[model samples]
Target: RTVYVNGAYLPETEATISIFDRGFLMADAVYEVTSVLDGKLIDFEGHAVRLQRSLDELEMAAPCTQEELLEIHRKLVELNDIDEGLVYLQVTRGSDGDRDFVFPSADTKPSLVLFTQNKPGLADNPAAKKGAKIISIEDIRWGRRDIKTVQLLYPSMGKMMAKKAGCDDAWMVEDGYVTEGTSNNAYFVKDGVIVTRPLSNDILHGITRKAVLRMAAEAQLKIEERLFTIEEAQAADEAFTTSASAFVMPVVEIDGVALGDGTPGPIASRLREIYLDESR
Candidate 1:
């Protein structure tokens, strides 16, 4: 495999970043991932926009133009011969002699890297067919959850907790309201109405979530962007999570309790079909 590091493409075995890079030392970096299907990048523009937003929020320098980034990504896909996979990109505050609370000198350039790899088809998992289970965890992340930063220890721990509980995913809850899954946007359907948390610093505004909303509107389904509690989710007729990779997948159970009939609901399936069609 080859990795795009700074201005050159290098073999993965040879690719390297400075040990003092803030992304590695202080986790001071932002990243984005976009899925590619049949050799074409899906929702590339949306991912680019979000990447820019994350950089701006962190007051970091833009390493390259969006067009340049797109070109790099295309070349990466070709170099890696990636067909059904994801493109990963990251920008970090450049290495410094030592860690400090203040930002690095303005003359220092941010490190930029990009790579691509295949993700197993979780959407087609037989467990997903029946719908998957999830467990709730406290949202113990920094307030800037909207930025796609590399500080993912909290979510990582949450996933471990979910696994120990025999759940497929973990939902982050704050003050009695469910925010989102560790790596996906959470949504639920109640009385035929689709509900999800509004875009805010409390959660990442997912591209797939936006696509699902658009699909729901086109399907003439009632959609609401509001906070729903764990109790409310457990009482929902259907539940699901969305991401660039997962697209749309139902949550059949939460906290070991079944939702509705413990089956993938029709609305979730229809939205998934619409999402996959439009994403192509």
Candidate 2:
């Protein structure tokens, strides 16, 4: 595979970052993942906009312009031959020769990196057919859940907890309501209505989430953005999640309880079809 590092394209093995980089030392970085379908980037503009928002929120500088970023994404997608995979981009505050609790000088340059992963059947994932079983975990992440930072240790641990419990993923709960899945935005359907938490600091505002909701609205699907609890989700007619990787994944069970015969619900399936159709 080929990767981009500080404006240079090289073999993945040759790409490197400083050990003292703020992104490595203090997790001071923002990142975005854009999926590719049919060798074309899906929602590149949306990802780029969100990337800028994350960078602005962190007071970080962009390594390059949006056009430059898009060109780089396309280049890596071509270089890596990623027909149906993802482009991962990261920008980190460059090293200042030493580590300190204080911020680096404004003159310090930021590091930019890009890479692609080749996924043969990213859109036609069989797991979407079987639906996902999820376990709920406490949301112990830092307060700034809105920023797309590289601080994924808790989410990784939550994924491990789900694996240990024989589930596909974990929904994080805070204040008795679901914040989101470990790596995706959470949602549920009930009585012909789609329910999810409103946008706030409580959850990461997902780019896929915004697109799915817009498509749902266009299809005249009813939506309710409010806080929901695990018990409510377990009793919902159906549930699903959205992310760059998994466009729309159905959830069949929650905390060991099955939802509607433990099958992927029709609404979730239709939305997935609509999403794939419209996105492609």
Candidate 3:
């Protein structure tokens, strides 16, 4: 596959980062992933705005203007003909001589990387049809998850633990409150009411999560953006996750406990339809 590094596009094997780059050395970077459907970018403007916010929060300059970035992303998508996949982009402080806490010189340019890849069709996966299981792990991420930074070791480990436990994903709990999934947003439905955590620095404020909320409102379903605990989730009538790839998927069980009837529920299916319709 072709990858865009800095201002150039080349084979993925040829794309490289400097050893001294802070992104490589200290995971000092931010990223955004947008799904491409039939060559059309989904929620492109929103993603771009969030990217800018992340960069600004980290005190890093955007490598290019929003229009330029969108053009580049479109070009890369066309160049690769990635019709049904995701576009991943990242920006990081540039390489510098070995240093621990000091910032790189102002003259240093930020490193930018872009790539696109096909995502497995979750709808076609039987696991999704049956609704996957999830495990609740303690939220061990840094306080700034709102920045969308690439430092993901804690979640990575959490996901691994989830996998080992025969679950499809990990839901992170903190101070007895459920935050979100490792790479997605968590939501549950109770008596036709959709409940998800409110946007905060502790969560990523997912694009799909926002879309789901909007869809629920249009569908006349009650929406609640507040903290919900694992115990509450386990008792929910329906549970699901949202992400760029997995638009909306039901969670039949959590932490070895079955939710409702232990199958995809009506509310999750309805919301999934709304999500796809609105997102497209």
Candidate 4:
């Protein structure tokens, strides 16, 4: 695979970053992932907008313009021949020759890097058909989740916890309500109404979440942007998650409790279909 590093495109093995970089040393970085289907980038503009928002929230400067970023994505997709995959972009505060707890000088430039992952048939992932089972874990992440930083240790640990428990992923709970899945925005349905937590610093404000909610509303599906507890989700008619990678994935069970008949429900299936169709 080919990768981008400091304005240079190179083979994956050749790309490198400084060991003292702030992003590596202090987790001072923001990132975005844009999926590609049929060789066309999906929701590039949305990701671009969110990327800027994350940077702005961190008091960081853009390494390049949005248009330039789009062009780089296009170039990498072409170079890698990626038809169904994702473009991952990251920007971090550049480093000085010496490491310090204090912020670097304002003259320091930010480092920009991007790469493509070829996931062949990513949209048609079979896991979406069989559905997923999720276990709930405590939300111990830092509070600034609204910023898409590269600090994913907690989420990665949650995924491991789910795997050890024989589930697909983990829903993070905080203050008596389900915050979100380890890597995606969580949702559930009851009486044909889709319910999810309202946007806040507690969650990442997923780009895919915004698009799916809009499409659901356009199809006249009722939505309730309020918090729901894990017990409530266990009794929900159905459950699912949305992310750049998994678009809309049905959740058949929660903490060993089966939702409905322990299968993907019609509402989740239909929304996934509509999302794929409209997004393409």
Candidate 5:
């Protein structure tokens, strides 16, 4: 596999960063993941725009222009022979050759890294058919989850928690309401109305969420942007989530309670179909 580090494309083993890199030392970085389908990038522009926003929120400068980023993504996809999968990109405050509490000067360049993960038939994941069972965990993450930074220790722990609970993934709850899935945005449907948390500093502004919701609305599915508690979601007729990787996936159960006969509901399934149909 080939990977990009700094400005050079090299073999995976050849790509390297300094141990003093701020992203590794202090988690001072932002990243984006764009899914690939049919040898093309899906929603690359949206990810790039969000990447810039995340960098801006942290007062960090972009490592390269959006056009350059796109070319890099294409090059890596081609070089890695990625027909179906995703691209991951990271930008971090570069090493200053010394560790200090203070940030380096603007002259210090930010480190940029890009790689491709090749997964065939990702859009046809069989798990989406059976739907998914998820457990709820406390949202212990920092306040600015809206920023797409690389501080993901808590989310990683949530995945482990889900694994231990015999579930596919975990939804994070704050103040009795679901914030999001550990790595994706959360949503549920009630009486044909789609309900999800509104965008704010509390939750990520999911790129797939934006696209799916728009498509749902255009499909004449009723939509609502408001907080819903775990109890409410458990009672919802249908539930699901959206992400660059997962697209739209059904949530059949929450906290040991099965939703609507524990089968993937029509709305969730339809949205997934619509998402896949349009995205590709």
Candidate 6:
């Protein structure tokens, strides 16, 4: 497989970054994942804009321009023969030959890397049909959830916790409210209305969430943006999640409680269909 590191494209095994890089040492980096369908990037512009926003919020320098980033994404997708899959991009403050708690000098350049995953049946993932079962976990990570940083240890652990509980994923709760899934934005449907937590530092502003909500509004589906507890979601008629990789995934059960006959709800199914149809 081909991967991009710094300015060079090379085999994945050949790609390298300094061990002292801040992204590795301090988790000081921003990243984005853009899905690919039919060899075309899905919402590339949206991901690029969000990437820039994350960099700006963290006061990190962009490794390259948006146009350059797009080119690299396309190039890697092409090189990797990605049809339906994902492109992962990361930019980090480069190593300054020494590790320190203080920020590196302004003259230090940033490192850029990108790669693609080939998922032939990404849009038709069978899990979407069966719907996902999720367990709830506490949100104990740092407060800057808004920034798309690589500090994902807690989320990784949360996913593991869910797996150990025989669940597909985990929803993070903070102060009795659902912030989001371990890696996606969370939502539920009640009496035909879609309820998802509003955008704030409490949750990562999902690119797919914005698109799904817009399409939902356009389709005249009832919508509401507010905090909903796990109990509320479990009581909901149906529930789902949105992310660049997963798109829209239905949630059938929460913490051992089934929602609506333990089946994927019609609204969630329809939204997933709409999302796939429109996105493709």
Best lDDT among the predictions, by candidate number: 4
Question: What are the per-model C-alpha RMSD values against the true structure?
Answer: 1.3, 0.6, 1.3, 0.7, 0.7, 0.6
> Cα miss at 67, model 5 (Å)?
0.3
lDDT of 1 by residue, 1-280 (tens): 9899999999998999988899999999999989987788999999999999999998899999999999999999999988788899999988666788799988789999999987555335466587879999999898988899999999999999988887778999999999999999999999999999999899998988887898899899999999889889999999999998778888999887788999998898888878877877
For 74-153, candidate 6 gives per-residue lDDT tens digits of 99999999999999999998779789988898888998989998999999999999999999999998998999999999
Whole-model Cα lDDT of every candidate shown, in order: 0.89, 0.94, 0.88, 0.94, 0.94, 0.93
Give the clashing pairs for model 5.
none
| Model 6 RMSD vs true structure | 0.6
State the displacement of the C-alpha of residue 50, model 5, in Å, after optimal TM-score superposition: 0.4
Give candidate 3 misplaced runs (Cα > 4 Å). 120-125
Q: What's model 2's TM-score?
A: 0.99
Model 2, span 1-280: residue lDDT tens = 9999999999999999999999999999999999999999999999999889998998888899999999999999998888999999999988798999887998789999898999999899999999999999999999999999999999999999999999999999999999999999999999999999999988999999999999999999999999999999998999999999999999999999999999999989999999899888
lDDT of 2: 0.94
Off by over 4 Å in 6: none
* Residues forming the 10-long window of minimal summed lDDT in candidate 6: 94-103
- Candidate 1 accuracy as TM-score: 0.97
Better of 1 and 6 by TM-score: 6
Worst ten in a row by lDDT for model 1: 119-128
Clashes in model 4: which pairs?
none
lDDT of 3 by residue, 42-136 (tens): 99998999999998998997899999899989998999887688899999987666756788877789999999987556335466678979999
Which ranges in model 4 have alpha carbons more than 4 Å from their true place? none
Residue-level lDDT tens digits of model 5 in 39-72 = 9999999999999999999889899899999999
